[model samples]
Target: MKKALALVIAVLMVLSIVACASPASSNTASNSDSGTPANNAPAAATSSDSENITLHFTWWGGDARNAATYEAINAYMAKHPNITIIGEPVSWDSYYEKMLTQLSGGTAADIIQADYKWASDIVLQGMPFLNMKDGPIDYSAWAEMPAEYAGNKDYVMGLATGINVKALWYNKEFFEKFNLTPSDDWSWKTILEAGEAVNKADPNSHLLWANSDNLNAFMQSYILQLTGKHMIDTENYKITCSVEELTEYFNYVKALFDTGTLPPIEDLVVYEGLAYASQVPEWLNGQWGMCMTYASNTLQVLNDSTFEIGTMLYPVMEGATDTGISMMPTQLLCVNKASPYQKEALDFVEWFLKDEEAITISGLQRGIPANTEAAKLLEQNGVTNAIINESIAVAAKHAGSAEGPFDTNAELNAAALDYIYQVAYGVLTPEKAASQTIDAMNAILATLK
Candidate 1:
């Protein structure tokens, strides 16, 4: 695959050249509408005004993640004394819907651990968030900001703290029982063959682990592996795959569903990995063999299994001209463009990204740290978060240390996911499904453009 170096360099120049504005200029009277006072509302009438900086921060994750993040926030507050960081955590299911209301109503939090899928839509649409480039925030620290973002001044919304690498995480015991080795050199065809072997070994067990909800991202990884192109192109507001290619991908997935090698779509939807791990289900009970997922969720999958769970890059295609490349881009922290605490927010973000205290709390649960110094601290502490370590290593090797594909708006992702469900459930043939998806997506992309 050709390097996107020229694209990357051009983005960096644009971010560096945007105009700077005052914190007051950025904040509007609408701040009060979000249930928070403006940044300069006379510093409060209280005598302890020095200890009154309240920053509301929001993120989406499971309970373990919430606890770790709150601990980090508490530690920061304990030292700062003068600052109070409000923690607003939500589950992934409802997070984006609630946040879209907040962003639209001008009630967005001071700091948002943003999804990359939503960054382009939110920032470029002027959804009332602070532009990092228009302030003193340093783009130099973020190595993963894609060329499109780096080069565009108006869309500079957030700083990425971590990145995720897609891979096939499997149980060692299952492979041992089948007398099979999880081959690093295996292609997608080989993976299907392995799945067939596992299916034959236990008719009740599935060889591949998945829910109906995740088929699109799985397809994205698979498509990128085959074409070296993104599912959605931010620049053109388009999907690049031909109709035939998309039909082939969806048909393959549908075949897996129909063959009993993967769970039925209806049964899988209620069994998200975060909610189902540790129950010793067919997968953890040593029934299912391999699962497609990210490093961040490996702990959830392996938390209860007695078998040694290992992670490997997404299986490539045999004799293919291109290597399988996992999509890489974890969420990031973005300031409300209307935020009054622009400088202070930047200061807090800078510390959060670069501070040792923050790194100790994060431990790459959300993603691999983008901060070099903070990553080094995690390394030196000799923590055994092997999944994170492995994810970082794989991302560096195959993902080129650049920002991954992004959606114009976060909602469009839901639409894309819906298309996956429609196709998977046999509501439409792969050809018709792909055509419907492209048509639906192109309509949404038009709104973004």
Candidate 2:
């Protein structure tokens, strides 16, 4: 368990070093620039699928995802008798570290899955990836091309696999037992009240099972909604929020900790690095009624729960200018520019997104499909999850400003995350935490540009 946090911290340290290195455009050495080995490498010009070759694809998810992905991979391989595609599935906690190691060593999977923001960081680090538009993917299938790549016309970082929004998942049984409703009108205050009620009735349980990552994201939403601006204005390379606003955000966070809506700091510290509800046992054992996770993760987050689960919009703030919830891509799928088998890899990627069989098998495992036709097919087959679809509606109905690239800078995020942790633990007051966080973020932002 300790290794989890340590490994996570190590990745952040590595990123900080990467960020401080020579400007990416001038960096000589890059993980993506590593040359492919002759023996197993695919011929650069070969576009035919007739050749017998093995390819590897990597992604991170829970048991449901693994099963669906494995099934899909098998289906693909079975269709192309000569091509063997290996599925490299990793747990969420260990994914980035492993992905980074592979990328640094020039051993990254032919098809690389990355968070959209991380994909930007990868490019900024001088890592090369294929301009997916030059490949076999059908652009017309997409209803809305992820605008993330709009400004960087030369690069389509990855073919987006799905679209998701940040939201909370509630256990129906627990909510019913406590006479609570996870309704569309629910607000931050409503959740706190519900949590207090749950704890009063059963001290052994808490209102939610949220870790550092989840809580940090919640803080981001609050800041965005309250100020109508993000903490960092990446385009200008500046810290955008005032300390007064941050103090308000922290005070709300403190209220959550104080009301027992979330467990004590000690209880969640060990699970700090965990990114999903399915990762912790508290959600599974019914010790918590709700957990915040990305909409894409609904199926996986509820994998083993015996209780029926429901989805709700991320709680809103009254009279807010923005919804504070933005629809984000699920994962960016890019072909390794260094891959010997770029042609074949692109073929598989195209098939995964455009093929009905692939889309149906994958289902809502990755949330709502980005491909218009794929979404239609899933609807035709009734393979879509109702709650997951509802989550998408909620996100659209209350969409806010899109998060910018620098808005989620790895180093700056780590700094603020540390402060949030301190505030939760009670040793740091909200004012001090907000002041220190602003100073720390400004110092990091100053290094930008």
Candidate 3:
């Protein structure tokens, strides 16, 4: 009985060996037939069997942007039946906080829409976003600003969709009523003088509409123009200007308030904390003659006004070393490094940025196209508006260095606004405000390091 059991075990061992050896040979033959190496055979087979893919794309914008993006996505899906794009659209107000949370949790969408200011924190600082330089996206047709912004380093972290610059928008009727035309000279003295004349003509109408955020943008530009340096030294992660330089900026702002070039702080209190002056009744009703706004926002401002609107280049300071007009990317598209569908995400982004059909459908919702060919195609289709073209021309002629990501540092921005308001409301002198602002900004910069 023992001898029979041993013989049976030996036979069973031989059969087990043959079973393993046969599958190995069969897999090798299968790989050869499929034109894949043994090492990649499993992955190749899986890809062939399941070619369908879904990609998640997220962005923050208004209803118009959402609708346009959705149409483009649907069109792409129609052309490529194997791909499905899931869009997560939200308002600009809640976008950053939500996206940051999602990023930390590793749940961000496959494709992400990032702001130019978010690049330092989200891309260059070792964030897990894919390096787009290795991808198939084309950059040859893009303008200098967009191309540089998209690929600032060894890796390309973002693909710019549009280019924008800080610009001034004025209500034409208000200017005409005050016997003032938007100045072609575009100097600080000229704007202030114009504002004084407008306010004098109609005490009820203010020369400019500004919220805290608006003031911050103006201050950044002013400081850059005066000092020929960025608000923050991106290389060293420090405040770029001295306390004396900051004092000069604060004093200039105070002078605007004191000379009635800008509306009284009390008058603007209701809109103090807002980022945009769009909802202010004075702006919508045309009581505010002018506003510092983005080039992309000119159309919306015009639509909101009952009167015709005009655009102006951002004013340069006297003896200014720089233009102070910071041309920046309005929208940037990126792919998550950890996403399972990286290839699909890159494919979609390339198509969206370079395809003629996609550009035609996108129109100017995000501002002027960053791709030179797309811009030409958009113009050929008659989708280019005069205001947008003018804005682009002005930026091309006068814009200086683009603002660094640290220029929009939230903590520093808020502190600067607080000090500015304090100076406006007489709680702090310009000298004190400047001192405080420098200290506060330096503290914030230290934390970043």
Candidate 4:
């Protein structure tokens, strides 16, 4: 009887174990079913079709400027649902260093906006350089550029972003006060004399403009005017000039500094680039008569100024070697070989070069639209911003003869500009400065090649 009881208990225990195992097996099956959807996966992302794509974009600008860019990019995203752009912006002070690191680290943006000064280095560093003819890069559409800028069948590093034409920015209030007229016929000689007259008339005020650094942009303009040459030429890989020409340029700068027409070096050091950016609050508020800058940027300083401003080309040097002004590529756009979405980037850039949307969004910050149709669109929009329109007009008139393929290594360009400043400050003689520049530039060029 006891053995029969034990056998019945064992059978009951086995039944209980079976019940537990059933539930556990069912739970495992349910979990596997839950993961089936994940294993099936979703579609890959791409530029076209239903695929999604993301592009990294970067630029340098102020807060207001960055906000405007954000708005533009947001609008672009709304139009193109599949494409997302990530913004990586920095202040101008940190822009170059940051970009260099990004590129060198092999994580550059898909489409980079480049300055002509840095294009050669970017290309030489093995970033899948593009020619104008790549896929849809339409250099022909860019009106501000010369026909020659068309991407060579070889390695074209960048596309024209905009044409930068330098011009004289005068305070309307001071011009009227001094009875000086803004004219195309005004020459460098006229500017010097007028500066002296304006300063003499108002001993407390400065008649001429000043920048913060030793390299005088003012000096470059006059030197270019006198010599019909540029300090750096990337196309032929030449630095054109003799020590004599540089010495004369430096002497001219010294005269301006000594004359009481322009600000002293010390004062200028405290007020660098304020003439363009109005960054120095005190100097901006102080009495300054005229400033020199690109036509596209003249309005930036005056937009909030209490005084009226006027724009015209810098005075041509009388009997100057070159009849035209020194113009440079203010900005450029290039496709990154490292970009995963090269085709999409090219298409977007093509649109930017040719589309109306790009013109409206850019607001011609870098310069006038290089595209012919884009320029017309800007005009049709009744934007009628004089600075941009004037820049466009100047570019249309004389971009071809503007000396440069200014593609010297960015470091060389910086070095050359630095030397120019040193000479202006009387820190070095023109001969020493010129020799140093040539040697440094040659070293840079050799490495680039």
The number of the candidate with the highest lDDT is 2
**Residue pair clashes in candidate 1:** 11-150, 11-151, 129-336, 129-337, 130-336, 130-337
lDDT of 3 by residue, 75-148 (tens): 99998888888899977786878877766555678789987766666654565566666445667777777334
- Poorest lDDT segment (10 consecutive residues) of candidate 1: 38-47
Residue 215 lDDT (model 1): 62
lDDT of 4 by residue, 233-265 (tens): 555566566667766776666667666567666
lDDT of each: 0.65, 0.77, 0.75, 0.61
Whose lDDT is higher: candidate 2's or candidate 4's?
2
Give the RMSD in angstroms, all C-alphas superposed, for model 3. 10.7
CA lDDT, candidate 3, residue 99? 79
* Alpha-carbon RMSD of each model: 13.9, 9.8, 10.7, 12.5
TM-score of 3: 0.85
Candidate 4: list runs displaced more than 4 Å.
Answer: 1-48, 127-129, 147-154, 212-223, 229-239, 273-277, 324-329, 356-367, 391-400, 406-409, 413-449
Residue 267 CA displacement from its true place in model 3, Å: 3.6
Candidate 1 vs candidate 3: the TM-score winner is 3
**Residue 127, model 2: Cα distance from true site in angstroms:** 4.5
Candidate 3 whole-model C-alpha lDDT, 0 to 1: 0.75
Enumerate residue pairs that collide in model 3: none
The count of residue-pair clashes in candidate 2 stands at: 0
Error of 1 at 51 (Å): 6.0
